[model samples]
Target: MTTFHAAEQGLAGLELMAKIREFERRMPLLSEEGLIRGSTHPSLGMEAVAVGVSLALRDDDAIASNHRGHAHTLAKGADFGRTMAEILGRADGYCHGKGGSMHIGVKELGVLGTNGIVGAGIGIATGAALASKMKGEDTVAVSYFGDGASNQGVLAEAFNLAAIWNLPVIFVLENNHYAQSAAIEDMVAQIDLSRRGEAYGVPSFSGDGMDLAEVYELASAAVARARAGEGPTFLVLDTYRYLGHMAGDTEIYRSADEVEAAKANDPIEKLLGQLIAEGAITADEWESMSARIVADVEAAEQFARRSPFPDPAEAFTDVYAKETQG
Candidate 1:
C-alpha cells in the first residue's frame, strides 16, 4: 500500500489505486486456481500508471492498450464483474468470452481494444485520433504499449503520421524495464523511450510511473495538448511489474532478491502510508476500505465462477481481418 498525498487529494484516487492493486493481486491467484484459461499477464506492480492516466481523461476519451491491460480497462471505468467473467471465459465478458485477458475492451467506455500483438494498437489509436479530428470531435485517443512495443516500426509510423497530420493522439509507453525475461538495457541502446518521439518533432515527457501524481500531471498536460490541436505527445513511464511475463513464467531471468527490493516501493503501500500521515484516512478507515475491496473482488469471482460459458456456435462470430490499403 502507498499513501503520499492520498488524504489531501480526497478518497477517489486512493480508492481507484486500491482497486487496481487488489485486482492485480488477485489475478495471479485466479490463474493458479485454474479459473483463467489460456495465459493471463498480471500488471501487479504497475497500477499507478493505469489509474493516473485514466483519471486524467474524460470518459469519452479513447485509449488502446497492450496485453497486460486489465488495470487500464478497469481504471477507465469498465465493469469489474464483466471483466472477471471475461477472464474466466464466461458469456457475460466484454467480448462475450472471446477475448480472454489480452484482447478485452469496453467500447462504451471508449477503450478501443487491448492488443495481444505487440504494437498493434498504436495504429488503431492513431486511426481513432484521425477519425476524431475529421469528425470535429474533441476526443483524444491514447495508445498504451510496453517498452518492447516501442521498438516496433509501427510505432514510428504512427508517430510520423500523427505528427504530419496534427492528429490528437498520445503515445504512452509503460517502460517496465523488461520485455519478458530480457532486461531492457540489454535489448535497446537507448532506454529513454520518450526521446524516440522527439526525433519526429513530437513533444515528449518522462517521469516516475510509480508516482501517481507525477503520472497524472504529465498525462493531463498531454491530454490538454491533444485537445488543443497540438498534435501528439509521447510519454515514457518508467515503471515495473511484480509478476513474470505470463502466469507460468519461471522467472529464471531475475532473482528473488531483486523482486523483494522492488516490493519496498510498492505504489499502493506508499499512498496508504502518506494518507494516514496526512490525516486523510484513519487506520480504521483504510481497513474498512480494504475489506470492501476484498468483498467486491470475491463477489466478482463468484459471478465469474457461476456465469455460463459462451456457446460453441458463436466462436467465429466476431472474427474479422479487414484489408488495409497499401
Candidate 2:
C-alpha cells in the first residue's frame, strides 16, 4: 500500500472519488423521475479506476470513454453542473443537449467523448495516439473500456496497431466480473485479461481496482512508461459495479448476496479507511468534505432541472461542418 500523505494529490483524489460516487448515486433517482430519458449506466462501485487514472494523466492527455463514463468525465475535471445538465438533456450541456448520457464530450478537457458502442472508444483513442505521435507530441491517449468490450475485435486491431507503431496509449480494461448479464468466465476462454496484450508485444498489468492507492500506483507507472515513449501499456483493473448494467435492469444474473459480498470491498470506504488510518485526514474532515460534495451534486441537479432544452432547430445544426469560402 502506498503511504498517502496529507498532501494535495492524495486528499484531492479522495474528494474526487467521493464526488464521483455521489454523482452516480443520483442518476437512478433522476431517471426514475423522468428527468433523464434514456438508459444511464451508473458506475456505482468503480470510482477508484477513474480517479486514479485521471491523476496520472496530464491536462493535455486525451481519454475516450465507454458507455459507463460519468466517473471518467468527472475525474477528468469536467464541470459538475454541465455534466448533470448534459444527462438532463439541457442546452447547457457539453454537447448542447444533443449527446445526452452516453455521448458527452469536452474538447478542452481532452475528453474525446463517451461512446455508446461497446468497443468504439478503443479505436478512437488509438487514432488520437497516432495523431499525437505524428505531431511529435508526448501526450498519451487513454481508452477506457469494460470487460464486455474486451471481446470486441477492435481491441485486438487497436492493440496491434498501437504496439507496431509505438504510439503512446493506455488500454484500461475495467473488468467488473460480468459483461452486462453474462459472466466473464463464460465469454472468454482465457480468464486473465491482463495477458491479452502479450501476443501484441504490449506490456500488461493488473491490480485491485477497489483500492485507490493500488490503482494510482499502477496508473502512474503505466503513464510514466507511455510518456517516456515506451509505447502502449494495458491495464486490467478488477472491479465491480454495485448497480445493474443500466438504470432499469432487473439484474437477474446476479443475486443480492453476491452484490452484498462485492460491496464488502467498497472503494470509497477502503480509501477513507486508509486515509483515516494514516492520520492523513480525520473522520470529521471526511464528513465535512462528503457533505460539501453531496450539496454540490444536489446543486448540479437543480441547475440541470432549471436549464432549458435545446431548440428544435438544433437538430439540423452541428450535423456537418460549415463551408468556408476559400
Candidate 3:
C-alpha cells in the first residue's frame, strides 16, 4: 500500500473522509429519533469510495447515485444542511422537500439525483452523458450503483449504448458482496462484474474500494479517459456497508463477525493513521478534526430539525411545464 503525505495532498481528502464518516454515523440516530420519516440506506463503510470518486470529478461533471448516496452528494459539494433537510422533508431541502432521501438532487451541483430502483440511475447517467456529447460539452457523468444492480438488464443496455456512441460516462459498481440480502456469489456465474464492461469493449477496472488513494487514482484515469471521448469505463469497487440494507432491516443475512472484520480496515481510520504517522497531524489534532466534523454534522441535524416542512399548495409548482396543453 502507498502512503500519503499531507504536505503533498493537503488535508482536504482526510477532512472529507472524516466528515462523511461522522455524517453516516449520525444517520442511524436520525431514524431512531424519528427525525426521518422514511427509510434510509446508510453509506457508513463506503465513504472512501464515494469521496474518492467524487473528488476526482470536475465541478461541472454530473453524477447519478443509488439509494445510499448521502456521501456521494456531500463529496460532490452539496450543502450538508440542505441534504439533511431534504432527508427530513423540510422546505429548505435540495428538492424543496419534494424528493426525500431516495431522490434528493441538486441540478446546480450536477447531481442527477439518487434512485430507489436498483439500476435505474445507470440509464440516467448514460442519458446525461449523451446530452453532454450532443451539447459538445466536456462533462463526464458517473453512475454509482451496488453489486445487486449489476444484474439488472438496464446496465447491459447502458453499456452498449455508451460504448457504441462513445459517450463520456463511468459506471461505478460498489460490490458490497450483498444485494439487499442476496450474496453476489449466488447471483452471478462469474465473480468479476468488470467483465461486463469488457464485453461491451469498454475499459474495465477493479480495485479496493476501502482505499481512498487507490480509488481516486483509478477514478481519475477513468474520468480523464471519458472526458477525452474514449467512451465509458466500468469500475468495480469492493466495499461494505456497516448497517443493514435499510433502517429497520433484521440483517439475518450476514453475521456480526463478518461486519466486524470489515470494520478493522475502516477507511476513515486508515486515512487518519496515515496522516498521523506522516507527522502531518498529531493524535490530538486528529481528535480535534473529528470533533469539528461531529459539530458540523450536529449543526446540520439541528438545521433540519428546525426547518419547516414544505407547504402542500406548492406540490404542483415544479412538477410540470407551464406551457403544457390539456
The local lDDT score (0 to 100) that residue 146 gets in candidate 3 is: 95
* Better-scoring candidate (TM-score), 2 or 3: 2
Clashing pairs in 2: none
**Residue 274 miss distance in model 1 (angstroms):** 2.3
Q: Tell me which of candidates 1 and 2 scores higher on TM-score.
A: 2
lDDT of 3 by residue, 58-141 (tens): 889999998988889999999989999999889999988888888988888999999988899999999999999999999999
Off by over 4 Å in 2: 1-6, 321-326
Q: Which candidate's TM-score is highest?
A: 2
RMSD vs true structure, all candidates: 3.7, 1.7, 2.6
Point out where model 1 deviates above 4 Å. 1-10, 320-326
Give the range of the ten consecutive residues with the poorest summed lDDT in model 3.
1-10
TM-score of each: 0.94, 0.97, 0.95
Summarize candidate 2's per-residue lDDT along 1-326 as a digit string, tens digits.
23434465578888998898889999998899998988999999999999988988889999999889999999999999999999999999998888899998999999999999999999999999999999999999999999999999999999999999998999999999988899999998999998889888999999999888788888888878888899999999999999999998999999999999999999888878877887889999988998999999899888988999999988888766689999
